[model samples]
Target: MYPFLRMVKELIKFRNAPAMRVGDIHISEHRCWPWDIDLWAELNNGRTLTLYDLGRIPLAQRAGLVSVMRKNGWGMTMAGVSVRYRRRIRTFEKIEMHSRAVCWDDKFLYLEQSMWKKNGECANHALYRSAITDASGIVAPERVLSAMGHSAQSPEPADWIKRWIEADAARPWPPMQDKR
Candidate 1:
């Protein structure tokens, strides 16, 4: 318990660090591969940018960014994402990505990420929201509050799951464009 408390303190401090230019947070610094691009294309609905693809970048860094957060008493579960594509990237093109923890509450963690070309032009930007959850998928807000060393009580879980279900039901899959 003491170790958990200490880790939580460190994570809170790290999250509060001053925001710097996107160039400061270096990613893997590897050249974009064709396979990666193809995966990106498929996940982005054949668009230039894909949230699923970008989400995987952190994994390639070997930084264990997400795992570290989890081990340090931070619950992590994807909440929502919004990505905007600026330009198309071709195969073999060198690109860079920047990521940072923007903000968080007892229930949610927010992050901002962006991709740039060799010329330093922004190619894509994304906002990712995640929440802390226990092994049973139940969010333990009190754990976050305790970790933060805050006296305030945790709020009830938001109806996010309900909203998600409703939204999903509202948008049925489109019919197959090409029938066999």
Candidate 2:
């Protein structure tokens, strides 16, 4: 058995340890600082949490998740991300964010996450996909499986690889200009 398999077996035993959650949003208290205002202001005419600040929650959560996998002797690299904002948040408003792993295939792991206002309304949602890799950043498929406590010949297949490739091909070169 691969050394990493032991860690995977342990993780599986406590797989449902807990639902990961994070965050609390802070709205603007003053408008004197234009630079700060510009950074936080949203297209919907409400102040937003700066990307720098909003990013902290996910960064910490990702670090924690990565630590879990690493402790199991598994390493991974982030591959793609998609975020959607549902409602405009203004100053003095509070929002809560939550994150959790939904599933994983042979090559990629999928995370489902969300943000909500104090009122319990969803403010945003996001999905993060990551690829398993080796210390050298090489895609070692069989190694990844073994690290996850699966047999080297596990039947799991990677469907996202094709989709990621096709999406890369179809992506536009540059974003469209805003006429306003």
| Candidate topping lDDT | 1
Query: 1-180 in candidate 2: lDDT tens per residue?
Result: 122442344345434444332222222111122332334553232222223123323333333544545665655556666667787555545555555444455566555555566677877665666566666564554454454444435333236634654575598767688899
Q: What's each prediction's TM-score?
A: 0.50, 0.46
lDDT of 1 by residue, 1-180 (tens): 113333344345345344332113534233455554565442132333343334233431223344434566544566667677787666677667666545445555455667778888987776666566765663544455345443354333246534543464486577447766
Those runs of model 2 whose alpha carbons end farther than 4 Å from true positions after fitting are 1-68, 71-75, 138-180
Range of the 10 consecutive residues with the lowest summed lDDT in candidate 1: 42-51
lDDT of 1 at 14: 47
Residue 78 error, candidate 2, Å: 2.0
